[model samples]
Target: MDFFEVINNRKTTNGPFDPRPISKEHQRILMESASRAPSHFNSQPWRFILIEDAKKRAAIADLAGRSMEKLIADGLFFERYRPYFRFSEKELEERGDGIHFDQLPGPLKPFAKQIMSPTGVEIMRRMGVPKMLGRDNRDLVAGSPLIMGVMLDKAEYIPGKLSGFYSIFGMGAAMENIWLTTHALGMGIQFISTPMEIPENWQQMIALLGVPDNLELMAVYRLGYVKEAQRRPSIDWSSRHRKRLSQYVFRDSCDTPESDDL
Candidate 1:
């Protein structure tokens, strides 16, 4: 694929992926691309564990589902991420960022605008939305053909230290490489992030992955081949819109916003 095309097309797959397992050659390419990412003084701090075992995937999925259910049941998910919910096309166009909840199920369409409000939380609870979402999340993770765990070397990832920041920066670059490679390879990937939202659940993930003391598990993601006919989830969001250049960039000085037209 063209480089720009791949970059533009790269996205978090919010729906189910094709049921086929990813090829070993493609997996090698993904890891090699990650290895090529630049690191601070070549202190390659990132580590990855590729998981394809059915039992392990099911275990991780259970953690993710339980976390999502708990987060929604307590209304913490909305409280924590309210700022990033865009309800309408106009709001999305104005912000040019954040996920747009444009693909809600039929019953949810009426209360869509209130999704960030306490009243909406109550309504969703009454409607069993939390449980529904949890099931969806569980099935998505369990169905994925591959799950990857990303870790950082503890010696280089100390918080409040220069090496810490550099390690994280390098890790992001490495993951971005992997993300782009997935797009180029006709595969889709999504962060299995709900498990990390709850502290106990995160700990469970670390234990389940058998993460060693020398490394800190940072994130988990599911990957698989993508089919054009794949179905969307019960509820979904689109993050295709991006901020205009002027919204994010500054010119030569901080006082001047970069013109989007330029």
Candidate 2:
């Protein structure tokens, strides 16, 4: 398959992966592919620590499991829904006499109201927290065969004072390479950003990976082989209208319209 096709077909796999050990040749190919990833100023800021040790994988899985348990026990899992619905700042201010909602940012004022809204509370109740907690537990218990820690160097320079963006961008490229290589090798891969525990745990994981203090752990990826291919959620690409090239294109002069074909 073409490289572009591989990218288009790439999907997250969380189901069982094949237990066969990855061969040296296959590992070399995957590492080569990752090395080909683009980086700013030829500075490859992304470092991948492959975890093949079963004991270490189990320990990481345990941390993830405990984190999820803590979140459930503390009722922090419901906080994930806060971004879906919120109230307007004006409504928040109107509801109270001394509650200066205007003092808050226009975008955030509504979030406070959302937490207090009856509908939001109802949605939270209907989220079936127990079921989600159970699923989280299961996911952690079935640890992946190949676990990788992605770290980013803080010294990498990005365009426009966005050093973090450059690091993440490099890591993103490496991640795509890893995914495609895994697929071609008849393996499975899944990204688990949610498994990131508290700041202290994050620090510990980074330390275990032997990354520099200036660098931070960006993500954790799991790889394995499975008979079942995870199906991607169908996207409604046609539902939204796209802008024509002419809408944003310009010629030599600022006001001159450029030919769409050109």
Candidate 3:
């Protein structure tokens, strides 16, 4: 695939992926691509664990599901991310950022406006939405063929330090390389992120991965080959919209915004 095309087409796969295991060649390419990312003074602080074991994947999935349920049941998920939920086309166009809920199920349509409110959360709970969504999340992760854990060296990833910021920047670049490579290789990847939202769940993941003292687990991702026909989850949103250049970019001076037409 073309370089720019690969970038343009790259997206977080929200649905389940094909069950086939990733080919060895493609895995090697992903790791090598990540390694090629530039680091601060060549301090390669990033580490990765490629998990293909079914049992381990199941365990991770369980934690992920339970975390999702807890977050939703306690109304933390909606409360914390309320700003990023757009319920209308006009809202999405005006913001030009954040996920747009353009594919909600019929039952959720009437409550779209108040979905982030406490009352809306209570309604969802009464409807058993948390368990339903939790099951969907679990199935998605459990069916994935590969689970990758990203880590950083503790020496370089210290909090409130210059090296810490640099390490995170380098890790982002490395993950971007891997993410784009997955798109070019006919595979899909999404972050297993809910577990990180809960402290206990995050610690469990670290233990399950057997992370060493020297390394800190930064993120987890599930990956597999994509299917032609993707079945959307019970509830879904799309983040295809992006901020225009004029909205986010600046010229030489901060006061001058770049022209989007250019």
Residue 45 CA displacement from its true place in model 3, Å: 0.5
Regions of candidate 1 where Cα sits further than 4 Å from its true position: 234-238
Among all candidates shown, the one with the greatest TM-score: 3
Q: Candidate 1 — number of clashing residue pairs?
A: 0
* Tens-digit lDDT string for candidate 1 (173-210): 99999999999999999999898988888999999999
lDDT of 1: 0.91
lDDT of 2 by residue, 1-262 (tens): 6778676666656455666666767767777888899987778887777887877777666666565555544445436533422234443333321222222223334544553355544543455433454455436334566777777776773435666677678778887888888877777676654456466666655665677767667887777765665432111011112234565678988798788698
TM-score of each: 0.96, 0.63, 0.97
Cα lDDT of all candidates, in order?
Answer: 0.91, 0.60, 0.91
Off by over 4 Å in 3: 235-238
Compute the lDDT of residue 93 as modeled in candidate 2.
Answer: 34
Model 1 error, position 65 (Å): 1.0
